[model samples]
Target: MSEGSSSLPLVAIVGPTGSGKSELALQLAERFGGEAVNADSMQFYRGMDIGTAKLPEAERRGIPHHLMDFLGVREDTTVAAFQHMARTAIADIRSRGRLPILVGGSGLYNRAAIDVLEFPGTDPAVRAALEHELELRGLPVLMARLQDVDPVSAERIGDAKRVVRALEVFELTGRPFSSFMPERQYVVPTIQIGLNGDRAELHGRLAARVHGMVDAGLMDEVASLIPEGLREGRTARKALGYEQFLRVLDGESTVARASEETIVATRQFARRQITWFRADPRVQWLDWSQAGLGGAAEALVANSGVAGA
Candidate 1:
């Protein structure tokens, strides 16, 4: 690493769900006197603990955590908002002479925290107009339009949510969504670590975790959110565990059926996350079970040229 690169150190722990990322990140924070920051989108909402698998205050092991449970479910917190918050958190942690450890499974959030991705400023009117169009014309129509204007971006963001985002940019700026995004160098030198395991083992773990969540009153959690007027909130309505529970609540499915559906959805999400992270060339992939916490921490520090505390 160059001298300039050596000064700004950020470590990121990324992986599919139930891959032990949170445990590894907490251990690293304890070992290096680091502060933990949430990079998972779902974890940003307050009162979304069990479903998001958030670490409780007691389980935080006395280390300070940033950006988790800081926003309400109804609030519109975008990637730009997260970038701003994470930058401030990182600066604050560094000022206190502590390392910043970003931990979560959200690949986009992880990239925003490390790379200097330019986000177009939020405009509610623009978002509302685009969302109206999406509701009218459907995602396929918007995706077709994106393909015509910016095939690269359309390919990169080939999802309903992303198609809406692209349309929002186009409506807001009268420019192709891709035009505003420039290739960026990392603003903070980062050690990006990805956790992996045998595909069968990962699937097994995911199923077990989903079952555990159900056993731990995931249905009650969803019921509480609904009565709090979160039934229409984008964050709460679409959360992995909460969505399936909603189905159960509506009598559309049995509890067993909901659990099965949740596991399937989570597995699909994990597959997408793996695909996204694998495409990023900067991440160093390792099997979490094989490397263990200590080895992974050492590897991250050594790769980033960050001396051990």
Candidate 2:
């Protein structure tokens, strides 16, 4: 290690779905003496393995991983809880003298893990009211309302869950939700390497990955979880693959249709993720098609001293 390269830059491998972020994180972890900390929201659950494309134990290459396989499928997961856990895992990894590699495509989870992002205090009454409003007037009503109060946030947050959270923040604090974005300041000096893939190629890869997951017993895994109250899980039930497959189990759709929907949704999600990660200027992107990506990332860290310290 060079002078100041003593501590690795709390490496975060972020990118869209099917961009091979997990593989890169594994390679970098093996080479850089690091342990991977899961930042994918879906992968936090214990039995979501096949659908989440979670790396099997044998595939981890003997590198220790943290913050994965701990949550039950029925439990609701919050970013606040994850932030607490992920930060603690990173600190523990550093104390053990190993690098901490944060990996996943869940943008909020990734940001929550490393950025100086704070979660606003929630009021159950406020949250319930928002939830009720979401059920009645639907997303458009809330979106329009948010546009009135915080157009910047309204433009950036596209989903109902996020919009509701932002609205909850605004109603509770009288502040625009966009104002809370941490200006990309890291709680710890961090190196975020985004995997960039060609759009057409990425789409093809995601489609194939969806097929592979289905072939790997995704339906069966989801079936087993139904008894475990997977449907009641506010967060888990909304997961990409699981959500579609649940429709299949409900007899509302065919497996073929579910698979197709998952592929299309995953592709759309990848585009959104690419856009999100690209907006951050701090990310040092790596072209996945390029040769020696792992070596290049190691060089990026080695060349910069005290990056994560």
For each candidate in turn, the TM-score is 0.91, 0.94
TM-score of 1: 0.91
Which regions of candidate 2 fall more than 4 Å away from where they truly are?
A: 1-6, 306-309
Worst 10-residue lDDT window, candidate 1? 1-10
Off by over 4 Å in 1: 1-8, 291-293
Model 1: per-residue Cα lDDT over 1-309, one tens digit each: 222232648888898988888888888887777789889999988888888888889998998889988777776577888888998898777767778889999887888888878887657887778778888988888888888877878877755677788877877777877777556467777788888878889999999999998899999988887766668786567888888888899999889999999899999989888888888788888787783556766666866666646
Candidate that would win on TM-score: 2
Cα lDDT tens digits for candidate 2, 142-255 = 999999999999877788888989999999999988888867789887888888967888888989999999999999999999888899887787788899999998899999
- Residue pairs in clash, model 1: none
